[model samples]
Target: MKIRKLIRDNNYNEYLMDPIYSRLLENVNNLNERIFQKNKLVNLQAFMEGFTFYTSLNYRSTPIDVLPRIISSEFFFKISNYLSARSYVLNKFIREVYQESSTPIPDWIIKTTPYFRSEMIGFSPPKNIYIHVYGADIVRLRGIPFILEDNLRIPSGISYSYKAFEYLTRFLPELSEGYNVLKPNDLEYLYDILRYVSGSKDPTIVLLSDGNYNSAYFEHRFLSDKLGIILAEPNDILVKDKEVVVKTVDEGEVHVDVIYRRIEDLDYLTPGLVKAYLRGWVTIANAPGTGIADDKATFVWVPYLAERYGMKLESVVQPLTFCLYEKENLEKVIDQPTRYVIKKREGYGGIGLAIVKDDNLNILKEIFKEYENFIAQEVLDFDTVVSVVNDSFYETYADLRFFTYYDKVASAVLSRVGIVGSRVTNNSSGGMVKPLWIIQ
Candidate 1:
């Protein structure tokens, strides 16, 4: 078989003999060791510095011998534009459907999460932009990439992926040679969004973290340092005189005009702080109640919303999704369990997700009894990527996490691959990371 065919078939022996694969594999082995040791020491230092959750879950490691998933520049630009336009349509839908009290918005979309309360409904931000940062998870099935889910609120992993790219380019120059790889400047775009929303030329920006115990605290710290902004935990901030301020030993109380928050649960924030945000004293990157857009049930209506808003998404491929709240959809999913994957409406970190196959029909039925807000999607068999674990080569399922800043795609991508025999490709759920590259 040809090299591509060999890779597709997971023929390890042939891959080992291919000169290009062998050289790349050798370089990756060295790069992996260096990164492993460096990450180990950095993680230890981070833990000491109160990044307690950085290494606690064993999800921070760098995977080995995985070639960067290559995409053409044409496809990259097309998809980015599609997602950007789609975001506008989605935002319009949210504003039109959920902004008015009398409008009939689906209860499952807004009420699925506790954070989307009545008080927050109709609460419009300065620009009516709900999703400033979006992480749209795309999976390739039968050589076509389909958007699996949209994460509108507090999308993590951009900083991590950017750091990983820096490491790759710094340590493995040989691998990046001859390829027109694009580097992501997400920090700039992020700052731009903050500036735009704050309506300030040089806004006082602060990255809010839940605490050191939050799983993505390392990323919070990384972003704060990289973007040259203050990293404040929930306790470090307070609302005084209707303005959000961060307390510091050096400056006493520093006024914060824009806050790029990393926390998902809005309940953890003080009422005063939320009030300050609502009053426009402070701007939040992803405004509160934006979780409705990320809710799994809302994903079923995304294409329809886009079309209704007169936005064409001809280049985009959305997976066939059904909201379980509908009786017909529920029966359809329950009858043919193997044909679909079920997920909770507000699920995150790969939790409350199940892939129903022939063997798990009975179990899924029992599980379904407990879930009122759920979504079922057509089963997509993702393309396999080569990976090396313990010096042995194997093929694993992979998906791409494409980050977008205010409807523009971030230049870099974070690829997550599942372990052998697993379907889910979330880092928190034992998935490994790989760098993605766009070949011009």
Candidate 2:
């Protein structure tokens, strides 16, 4: 099969050559054929139907792979351990960034960054953690993985990853034969984090959302249901006398101790909630203004900040970034634009990116006018997985997004793949998300 060939022939997929992974791929291959053929649906129809069902699980419109990819427990643990150490460094780094005066980050960058929230200057959230939940995109070059970006701003997709694993396993129980495929960990500890932050043994925690229109609204609802917390909309949440409360169907004006926020805009956070949060009457999982660390320009300082804080990531390294704000860096990229990918500091969900491919001089010159808002980074010829879609195996570009709690350990991962002819693996685009199955 093409998947077997993928493992055998592709140098980047050398890890799949292991006997256990090979066997798992064979089972996935067999199952893919069965799932497609038995439906008697046309190829397009089959893929559409499968994707429809996947989205019905309430993930915002992203297709999933036909089968879960194999990851070793050892590798995952190693990644988690390394990430925890990195988190330790970042936590200290953030503390320094928010300081009134002394900081390693350039004052101009901090003051100019749109993501910087000044409201958080004096306040410290529970555990003094600004990044309560963190997510980072990881892409591999050759066979080695490096972090692509950080999502410290109320990161989404953990719930989606959990649901994907839950449903995929149920859909293909037989595939688990002779394999110890561990289920993804639950997010119940989020409530514990909430409670600890709130300084309440039984805090009234509510999952605050931007509502159903948001792409991660499903995550908001799913997490609320899973953690047994009330899911409150903006209108539903109220802050009175600096103590937050939520309107309820059964219990009117119920007091809320913690708000597990899903929205990023501080405006949506409501002035009353902000006041309550500042007063320590309520806790927001990620305090407002965490965007300081979340900014791309600030990301360039992570290595420096880590070193300055007397900690460094020992396991995985991140890509080298070139800030376009520098005239010399701009000249170098203009000299050879094709070697790097140009990205706007504020852009997310695969937007505001230029690959600088053939004959892209005009666009590059135009975008360069506002070079201060962009950064250029070396392009990675990242590794690809054999992603089976509609009973066909396509060597697909893939990346992993690891989600972690402030306690410094990665708890869940969402693996995403871009179907052939696509560059980005973000779910908001046409990419597919799936569970990264670990062999325990």
Best by TM-score: 2
Over 122-207, each residue of candidate 2 has an lDDT whose tens digit, in order, gives 66667787778888888767656688888887877787577667656656676677788877764755666677877778889888
User: Candidate 2 at residue 110, lDDT?
Assistant: 76
Instruction: List CA RMSD, all candidates.
Output: 4.3, 3.5
Which one is best on lDDT? Answer: 2
| Worst lDDT 10-window in candidate 1 | 11-20
Q: Write the per-residue lDDT of candidate 1 for residues 32-125, one digit (tens) a residue.
A: 4553444444434434544323446443443333355566678788789878987786677667655765333466556555546466666888
Off by over 4 Å in 1: 1-66, 102-108, 111-115, 358-367
Alpha-carbon shift of residue 405 in model 2 (angstroms): 0.5
Clashing pairs in 1: none
